[model samples]
Target: MKILVIEDDRLIGDGIKAGLGKMGFSIDWFTDGKTGQAALAAASYDAVILDLSLPAMDGLDILRGWRQQGHDEPVLILTARDALEQRVTGLQQGADDYLCKPFALSEVAARLQALIRRRHGQLQPTLSHGAVTLDPGSHTATLNGEPLALKSRELALLQLFLLNAGRVLTRAQLEEKLYSWDHDVSSNAVEVHIHHLRKKLGSQFIRTVHGVGYTLGDS
Candidate 1:
């Protein structure tokens, strides 16, 4: 999934970027609130990691603006403020979840996964299509009960396909979800990934709609 992280602290921001990246998420990070908010407006994201304390604009204000403007992507507030009132206010402003500072990367990832799942109306933790099963929390997958060894990008792509099982996804849509702004993606990046996935999971696992796009096929 793609995520936007708006944080001022360099240490925290870098840690989040690296940690989440390892977990198969494409992360776009900005230190200033205005820049982060603008990034959200420019592209699609599965979720947002927002810090209450921000430069140029406050996190709550950003969240309020997004909600008012009907940007319904899930937002998770991660801040140092631990007061009950602050937490309530954040949620009231439309934060889907809240995590206090000095937090674990695992917890943050878990919360983000939950928010994404809820947004997709997915009630199950593991995503499965036929004999394929993926556990986001464990960063693991199994094919026919055997361990599936997949690179991070491949794993993320599979997850995206599973999330939108019946919908046809264009190459542009796949690129948007799979890459951050900083990535200089090649023209055939998505094709290469799709080819790799088909080789590993079988060509019938993903069906191509002639003159259109691709969709998850019967497994």
Candidate 2:
């Protein structure tokens, strides 16, 4: 999944980026709200981590603006512990969840996962299709009870495919979910990752729609 994090605190933002990247998420982080909101307008994201206190634009304004513009992507607000009123206002303005300062990466990740699951209406953390299973929290995948060793991009593709099983995902969609903005994505990037995933999970696990894209199917 692709996430946009708008946070001014470099330490917290970097931690969120690194930690979430390991769990198979592609993150594009902006330290200021103006750039963050512009990025949201220009691109697509599965979710967003928005800090209420921002330099150019307050996080609340950004949230309200997105909501008004009909961008209903899940948004988790970041706030100081003492700002209960502001946190409540954020929720009223369409924030999905809130996390206080000095929080653990584990908790942040867990909350993000919960928000995503709720978006998909799935309560289970493990995603499975046939004999293949991928766990987002642990960054692990298994085929028929056998653990599979995978690279970062490979794991990300597998997770996306499993999450969107039975749907035809175009190359653009795969690329969006698999690579962050900073990553240089070659023309064949998606194909390469798909190739690797097929080798590990079996060729029949992913079916091509010819002119369309790929879909996860039971073999």
Candidate 3:
């Protein structure tokens, strides 16, 4: 899923971006609220992590503008203000979830997962595609009732492919989901991962689209 994180603090932004990337979510971050608004106006995202205090524009205005324009995507408000009134206003203005400052990264992740689940109308924690299954809560996977031993990135990659089965996914799309913006990807990193997946799963699990990207094979 694609997420937009509007945070001003570099450390906090980077931490959230990295943590979510590891969980197989594509992330784009903006330090200022204007840029965040621009991003929201430009592209569709599964969810948004918005900070209340921001440069150029505040988080509340951003949320309000998005709603005014008929954007109904889930938004989790992140702020240092824990006042009751602030929470009410945030919720009243269309914040789906709220996280206070100094919060645990795990909590943020859990909330985001919940939002994505709601967006997709899925209440169950376990996701399946064909013979493969993934448990987001436990970070576990199995294929045909046998455990699928996979590295973290490999697992994330598989989950992404399974969720998007039969859809063509470009290298840029895969890399954005697997790695953070700051991480440099090797020229053949995606090819290497695809190779490993085919070896471990069935050879017919994936199909390469010459000169374009890849798609899941018809099983």
* lDDT, each prediction: 0.94, 0.86, 0.84
Better of 1 and 2 by TM-score: 1
Tens-place lDDT digits, model 3, residues 1-219: 678999999999999888877766668899999999988776667789999999999999999999999998899999998999999999999999998999887888778878877777668877777787777655678889899888777777776776676689999888766764556889899989999998988887788998889888875
Better of 2 and 3 by lDDT: 2
Q: To one decimal, what is the Cα RMSD in angstroms of model 2 from the true structure?
A: 1.5
Colliding residue pairs in candidate 3:
none
Estimate the TM-score of every prediction.
0.97, 0.93, 0.82
Among the numbered candidates, top TM-score falls to: 1
Across 73-161, the per-residue lDDT of candidate 2 in tens digits comes to: 99999778447787788889999998888788888877887787778767899888888888877778899999999988888788777
For residues 1-219, write the lDDT of model 1, one tens digit per residue.
999999999999999999999889999999999999898889999999999999999999999999999999999999999999999999999999999999999999999999999999899999999989999878888989999989899999999999999999999999999998899999999999999988888889999998789999987
RMSD of each: 0.9, 1.5, 2.8
Error of 3 at 189 (Å): 2.6
In model 2, where do residues sit more than 4 Å from their true spots? none
Return the candidate ranking by TM-score, descending.
1, 2, 3
